[model samples]
Target: MLEKIKRRIEKHQAQPIGEQRTFAVFLPLVKVDEEWHVLYEVRSNHISQPGETSFPGGAVEEGESFEEAAVRETMEELNVSKESIEVYGEIDFIFNQSHHIRCFVGELKHINPDQLQPNEEVASVFTIPLRYLKENEPEYHTVTLKTEYNHDFPFELISNGKKYKFGKRKHKVPFYRLPNQFLWGFTADFTHRFIEIISEDTNFLEGKNEK
Candidate 1:
């Protein structure tokens, strides 16, 4: 049995445990007027979260790498070819029991936000100057998480049964109030993380707008 387990481990590719839906997003940075700007998409009515702000990204398909999915989603959403995009590198990624999101930072050459034609998934495209984002701070909110169990769950198997003590884990949601847009949730977390890296100050964003 030990030998069999050793053989299995040799061929195993380590990945996140449990079932996870993988995703990737490209933080497309463009140079406008000698300054850098970050582009975002407003979800159109065709998608579920219409009018919500987001970056170019989608689910990672089977047999596709993280970068490949990011680039493919960018091309399909922005209506641009892969040749127009130059992927610099990856910053960091997010992993949870249900989701794994990877972010890639790169530049978009020879094009502006107004020039690109987006797909049905995109309602419109807009740009936020990196300098402006670097200057402004975002808000953070911590909310409680609901606890539920399967109806068939065996309550008698554990001590205290229905009154058993369970650890409290709250969700940390972020909000970025741009001049005209309101960014929040996981997307906001990604944006805040990117800013932290580029600004070289992990604690740069304080709770100025916390609630």
Candidate 2:
């Protein structure tokens, strides 16, 4: 079943598409223990997107394809060579107000936590069980604005923060919870969607009694 998914992704990658956009690859390290685990990273405070939790990936450079960028970023960030990764497939593409995200999934045959190079853009690295994410229910909230258009945004979860209210109007600064990780903004959205797709596939295969 994983092979089938991989073939479909390769076909998509091979097709030529115009209007190329900035793409990123997210390598989700899955551990096969009593339960499945997925790796995550905390962004370094020095970076613009600081304290944010995300997978190891960045913008695709000029003349670089999505796969190349993914492989390169993974090697640089995790210090894990390309040969150690077994590309499985890709997750759904997530588009934010700022950028378009192209995500891919690969397996790590071996991992040495000590060898991980968390640069100025990355603070720390960690892993959490997949079941924790699958069971958590997210709460979405919105805020209205008096801009060109009245916009209401959705925030998955909230933390202990200030909630401001106007005359019949209110805005809440919320923080999203990802079990052991905290996710927000584009990275959060991308990871959430990726997990949803993988979980669905796993469930479908389980129902069919396929290994």
Candidate 3:
């Protein structure tokens, strides 16, 4: 199944797409009980956005492709070798009010969770069942915030068993969650959309098989 997904993804890469600002998020996978688990990272406190649960990824660098940046960032952040990860299909493109993000799923044949290097920007690594995300209603919260260009917009955050409230300042506004790991901002939005796409695809395949 993983190999099939990989082939599907590779086929999509051949098509030319419009030029737009894009970033990549990696959905790392591991197998357990013949099912897949998705890996996520808890951002370290030393970083600007501390304690946020996010995929190991970042902005695409100048002169670098999105796939290159995804693979590079994942390797750097998780200490996972590039050779071991198999590229699966991409998630839908998320258009943030500020920028756009492209997400990809990748499979890791052998993952050493204990060897995950906590970079100054990454506190820890964690995994949750892909099936859980497919089935559950993720909690959401409202956040109002100003962009870097000084524009205010209403934002949303997906709560991961964390408490949060809305707060504002003269220049900035945010949804302040209790000082623990909560998935919010672009990361949360990307994650939610990714799961939605995967669920739809899985259902479609199931229906086809039933026929």
Candidate 4:
């Protein structure tokens, strides 16, 4: 298995660049009554990003590849066997300043949501139909993050006792509203792009599945 994975990596010619805080997520899709749906997890209140909806995943650990991390995290959180997951391929990489996320898509085989056990990091599991995402557009909201500095004596040496301009950073946040549920932030960003890619490749807007 390791040899096969090594060949696949070599085929893609992928390499890690520098030292980055990396994360990986699996976009698990399942068939529900002839329609494809995307699964999501609501983070536990005790964990980071509490109550936020995201795909099953976690940080990439030492000696583990991005794909390995994705599978491991999904298994740990959802308590599903690795054999049940069929990883298709990576969709895209999301870069947010210093860190980045490796996004992958896959199908979960014979999954019973009611029977699945969630760990402490997961509050509940839910699904969003692919048709909904392909049809509806996310609400775009922009905000600027201003830099804050402490009052210290070092400002005089750098700016010659004059006030220096510190620029603010702007970001466009995506929000997808589905019934009573709302998906925003990095989760929404990845999902939005995934929908676009599949839509274009498969003519999803015309109600066709990917070949």
Clashes of each: 0, 0, 0, 0
TM-score of 4: 0.85
Q: Which ten residues in a row have the lowest lDDT in candidate 3?
A: 169-178
Clashing pairs in 1: none
Q: Which candidate is the best by TM-score?
A: 1
Rank by TM-score (best first): 1, 4, 2, 3
Whole-model alpha-carbon lDDT for candidate 2: 0.67
Per residue, candidate 1 scores C-alpha lDDT tens digits across 71-94 of: 999999999989989998888788
Error at 34, model 3, angstroms? 4.7
Q: Model 3 TM-score?
A: 0.64
lDDT of 3 at 141: 59
Considering TM-score, which of the candidate structures 2 and 4 is the better prediction for this target?
4
Q: Which ten residues in a row have the lowest lDDT in candidate 2?
A: 147-156
lDDT of 4 by residue, 1-211 (tens): 9999988888896656666689999999988777789999999998998988999998999899999999999999999999998999998888755678998999888997757798999999888889888888799999999977776646767763547777799889999877766699888988999998987764666887763
List TM-score per model, in order.
0.88, 0.66, 0.64, 0.85
Q: State the lDDT of candidate 2 residue by residue for 36-152, as single tens digits.
A: 556778878887678777788888998898878887887777777788777788877866445577888877666655466756677898876666655653455667644231344
Go through the candidates in order and give each one's C-alpha lDDT: 0.86, 0.67, 0.68, 0.87
Report the Cα lDDT for residue 142, model 1: 92
Model 4: weakest 10-residue lDDT segment is: 153-162
Please list the residue runs of candidate 4 whose C-alpha ends up more than 4 Å from where it truly belongs after superposition: 1-20, 160-162
Question: Which of 1 and 3 is ahead in lDDT?
Answer: 1
lDDT of 4: 0.87
Q: Return the top candidate by lDDT.
A: 4
**lDDT value, candidate 3, whole model:** 0.68
